[model samples]
Target: MHFSRVPVRTLDTDEKSVAQFGTEKMLESAVLLADSDLDAVVTLSEEITKATGLPCSTSTLAQVEVLKKYGVKRLSLTGPYVDGPMRGLVAFYQGLGYEVLKTSQMNERNNVVFGNTPLVRIKELIREADHPDAECIVVACTNWPAALVVQEMEAELGKPIYDSVCVTLWKALGMVGVGIPLFGWGGLLQDDPILKKMEDVLEILLTCCAASRTTLRLDFLQKNCHVDTVCAEACAAGIAQLKQILVQNDLANTDIPPPKALMDVYAVRAQMLAPLVRGDEIYGWISVHQVGKTRVWTEDEIGELREAVERVNGILRTAGWI
Candidate 1:
């Protein structure tokens, strides 16, 4: 039922609300840090930016130095570093005047590598995402098989870990935002800038609603007739359902023309009622009007359209958007 990186432990016992200590828990445990580690971290600032080909207004050098000076060398690297700038990072580190080491991909928990790096099955979340922005990028798990390969993993990934342990540490340290330094392991000590950016993109894509949802005035639905109050309310509800579908797909801010719009059809005067079913559960809908320009759309066609809109509507309801 949870969506974020914070782990969910479903309780069978009688527990009131759960306390989320994902990051804070990690930070409470003491770890040592240093100022020179920042030097080692900065050596690759340019290298990482070059490898990523993304502009970095923030200084990763200063961030790395902070982690190096204050990071705990606890045996919590998370899983082995996989699915990153694997080869390029090795070269980048060598150029940074640092020793780059690597380790075999292991599965202390024996996780099957389904699809390389970010594994995906056929018709998987990553695949059906269809849009690149829709894919969930999980960079780490508390039980990652590579927890033992901290130094080697960082050198290999060329990015902050952002794994389960990493986020936990970041979350914990964020509670006290003093300019403290981590020596070597842990993460960026605060927010992983790259991860934060990825999260921002994901949030926009997952939560956006279509800007093109033109609410139909029951009265002016076609050319100049407005629907009565009761019918108008129902239509508004159905249109809200339509909006949910567009938002889930990140297809918000739609700019399609009237002829090519999601809900741009006109309404006139022709009527009938039909059965509407959600699984065995059924509701009812009667035709309100017809388009004067186009031929009257049949009951079957309208029924199908209603079903599509309702499917998304159900999701909106589940998401608590009644």
Candidate 2:
């Protein structure tokens, strides 16, 4: 829940320098927070696209998540970038399947000028960026002082105003299951019953993933190679398949179909395993089981298992484990 900001030592207006600075700062922040007691980190710059190998926008993926969370499809953007970086920003949003209705960029791209630009000027820019079909307006730079006026402007404009800094904060808080409804930050910061439930489910799954990883590692040390865990069972079957299930447990065979043996020992009837993957690299697998009689695996269960694995993958990325 604690935050520490480390300013990247580079001019915000210099696109190349800003990209490099963002990459370094992201790594720097991850390393710093990873060693501390903090559970997560949120990199504020949406302009830092180089590290993730994303086209155009650096923060587009995270922003897209924000958009998806709020069900916003079309966007109007106002930022302090010059023409060169501005094009990249627009392309980034377009690449993510969001319709960019209108955009306004300030002629002055100086770092100090952008950071110090008057709120009145930004209000005008927001108006210029507004469009009839746009669902939201994004103040697309972290350094630009937008948070001070976001909620107020949104009230006047009758549309959501998403400041990059606010979005980053909202996203970071959401990921950790802190759904506090803070006023003066626009609709994204408000409480959503659906999003809260989703966050609660995600937090539970993340906890399960961490506990599973820990249990597997501990069992690996205890068993001394040939880790007889749920994932190991799944790996024995096949990594390509999403899940491996043994519904009815027969306790006669303990060696073959290790999952069954493990299930038999625990008196479990059904087991399912999903691969934990980062890009194409398969780190390990995850599993779920039922202790009672045979149970049919539904499509929703399978989908949720996959989502749990992906959530674990996300945690791994944030922790620099992948």
Candidate 3:
């Protein structure tokens, strides 16, 4: 459905702008959105729809008054907001001389609230739907942020959720339906026929890896510096001069950098994986970052960071992210 997201500002300039309402400035913000393609406009439940719904603004009661004035009988009555506010929304809609079509019993404060499951709850709500007389469910209040959850709710409820945003999307997707599967909101959009297949495939790929979560990325260096390489080789050569010293310390080949570099090639990370292999075979793999966030890498934590990148890449490839 047409999901409408209102905007909230953060403390910084990078904050994303959205269509929102809270004060007179917010109400006047509509002029900015006059060219906006939003399907549903949201406002307070008690405030007159004449401002939002009818342009000049009118209350639900006043909206009915205006509709009656226009000889419009088909009132797609919705509301009660999430938790139905103080009273039952069904009663409120009935009071407006229109039939109650759908009610999500939603948590009305979805816009700013993090981690609310409008999808899961509405899925449960639609199971009890029964519509016989209304042309369409008016949906709940606009501010409820039920747009994403509406379609899946309708698909299951055997009737529409009639949300403002969802209705707008319903009108937009009239005959052609979208197939992208979203996980956070919009109920069945997360579990639609096609989305389930992809998520299932993605899950399987992830489960097939046993890599450490420490990877790194480095730049595409042209080659090892000649001066640095000469220095490194000379240092390794000096290890022989102190062979007696190493043996005295119970450390063999300890004076050389060659062995460490080989064991940790380019300081790359190695990960031993126990994937769900077809047989009992396991794989030990090494990976190179090739590019990274920083210009030069740090000496410490390099191995672990490199390993994490390997792990992530393997998972992505297995999941077809490559």
Q: Write candidate 3's Cα lDDT for 193-213 as tens digits.
A: 322333333233323322112
The CA lDDT of each predicted structure is: 0.30, 0.58, 0.35
Model 3 residue runs over 4 Å out of place are 1-23, 34-92, 101-104, 107-111, 129-136, 143-145, 168-322
Q: Candidate 3 at residue 272, lDDT? A: 24
What is candidate 1's local distance difference test score?
0.30
Off by over 4 Å in 1: 1-138, 145-148, 190-322
Pitting candidate 2 against candidate 3, the one with the higher lDDT is: 2
Candidates' TM-scores?
0.20, 0.52, 0.31
The best candidate by TM-score is 2
Q: Which tens-of-lDDT digit does each residue in 161-244 have in candidate 1?
A: 434444444433443343333323433432333223322322332223211122211121222222321111122122221111
Best by lDDT: 2
Each model's total of backbone clashes: 30, 2, 22
